[model samples]
Target: MNKKILGLVVSPGEAEKKVNTLIDMIPCALKEVSQNTEEWQVQTIVDSLTGSAESINEIFQKINAHTKKNAWDVTIGITDLPIFHEGKVVNADINEKNDVILISLPSLGWKLKKNVIKQLIIKMALTISESDNDSNNKRSPSFINIFPRNYKSVRLKIKETDSFHTRFILGSKIKGYMRILTGMTFINNPLNMLQTLSGVLAIGFTTGAFCMAFTTMWQLSYLFNGWRLLLASVSSILGMLAWITVSHNLWEVPSKKNRKKFRKLYNLTTLSTLMSSILIFYFILFLLFLLLSVTLLPPSFLGQTLGIKEGIGFTRYLDMHGLLLL
Candidate 1:
């Protein structure tokens, strides 16, 4: 029987054609090496039993045991395994004693001498969702990808490697296998739940401001013949000003930490505005709208229409003046 090399991939879901492509590339890459090394040939290729880490390990263990007892000189590499814990992708490496698993690529054959590379392809070769019917191979998703969210990763470092922070592979060493995880998962910090909550709040405040402005200017004052139009105008102006000065200002900051803090503050302000009695809020909004209009409306028209210098009506002004005396 020909000696076989097994490349195992653990993924989020069903195996796709991209996995097959990666397998095809392996043999071509390894053949270019000097003849002195083991004249390896890829015999049988297998997709593992399941999408779990334990399944991957079981398969590798079985292969190792079978190969070892037979002394078949078979080489096996396991990669593209997704290990998801918590909400982030953790990088773990497979090593055994001092022997490292080789990432057998013809280009980086130097690094493959003693390192095991957890085969990861960031770009996908093909991914077709249900709704999409683009059968052409060009439209497919990546052939090589780890996973979407924070999932599993392989983390390993060589002492003399220049880019220690970047991903690399090592060859098998010593006897048994060793797994290493540095406890780091995401490249960027994880988003807080509170950040999303704040966005919901800001949206509510802006919407209320617009609705109140419209009601005060066009509906409430004309329907009731109310003196509260001035008040409505004032409230509208204040709300708009508050949105621009306080709410808008707070949300635009670059730092996620600071934006989160401001978002919480604005959320509270919006809630308090909404909690007020509906009738009272309407009146307040009307006053703001009227106040803003007066800045643009003519004093002459105010006097002709309402018998006042500004937009205030004379009877209401005198009544307020007389009440102050009483």
Candidate 2:
């Protein structure tokens, strides 16, 4: 079979680098699809179209005219402008004729923009070239829809063909990390950053609290010999973990009834656990302060403030030798 050459038109000269990158990646993306389906050949001819069109329809019409004039099998237009379908922003739009695909860079957003565009462009190319019309491939509502918010749903179902599975798998593997790094760095949207930071802080606080409780138990071991202190510390940490799990489930679970019930229980348990941990931590600190006062404070001050005789040494109060025994 002869290679089917596709023309890629880029308007608004500023997007040349991004468009060129997509053009370079398309061949690699289509490699599996082409090999599996009777040696279908695909090539891209990149062109820079000057001037701008007022609407997405105008952009399509202009590109369509060029594709018809050049007798190209397919044409894709890459533009920086935002494109909309039925009032909602779309990352890319494919005409039913399958001869033209228009990509709106702004709709892909700043985070993972290039990778997403590459995936979308490749999907479009393979989709247009697929020969099996009987295969029930549900078209995504929008190009952004192709990149589902849930990572598990990132699979692109193109005619249920095994070769196309590679495309979806490759795209899904990197998407999760890309989104995380993008949220941290490139996008820098305040809400996203705050949400991510809050999650980190929640986990950090839980771990820190557990460690502090254990440290408190160890320190208190000098005063108490029984397993009661150890049991209490372990119980407190377990309580904290339970509260965290409930709260996390409350936030993640979609069922309204379960969420409502969990929300109330989470709030009560979280408050109780938090208060207990704070009190325990503060008691530990107070003990440390008392130990410091006894070990370091002058006998004169101790006699005046603690009402102790001047002859008594600080070690007499804390029994430093006993503490060292542990």
Looking at model 1, residue 200 earns an lDDT score of 40
TM-scores of all candidate predictions against the true structure = 0.25, 0.40
Best by TM-score: 2
Q: Write the per-residue lDDT of candidate 2 for residues 15-129, one digit (tens) a residue.
A: 5665666665666566665674433333444454433422445566677787888776667777755433223344455665434777654444444467766667666766665
> Candidate 1 has what TM-score?
0.25
Q: How would you encode candidate 1's per-residue C-alpha lDDT over 152-219 as one tens digit per residue?
A: 23344434322222122222311101122210111011122224335543554455445433423223
Off by over 4 Å in 1: 1-16, 22-24, 35-38, 47-81, 84-92, 95-326
Question: Candidate 2: which stretches are off by over 4 Å?
Answer: 12-14, 36-54, 131-326
CA RMSD per model (angstroms): 19.5, 16.1
Give lDDT per model, in order.
Answer: 0.32, 0.48
Clashing residue pairs in candidate 2 (N, C-alpha, C atoms within 3 angstroms):
none
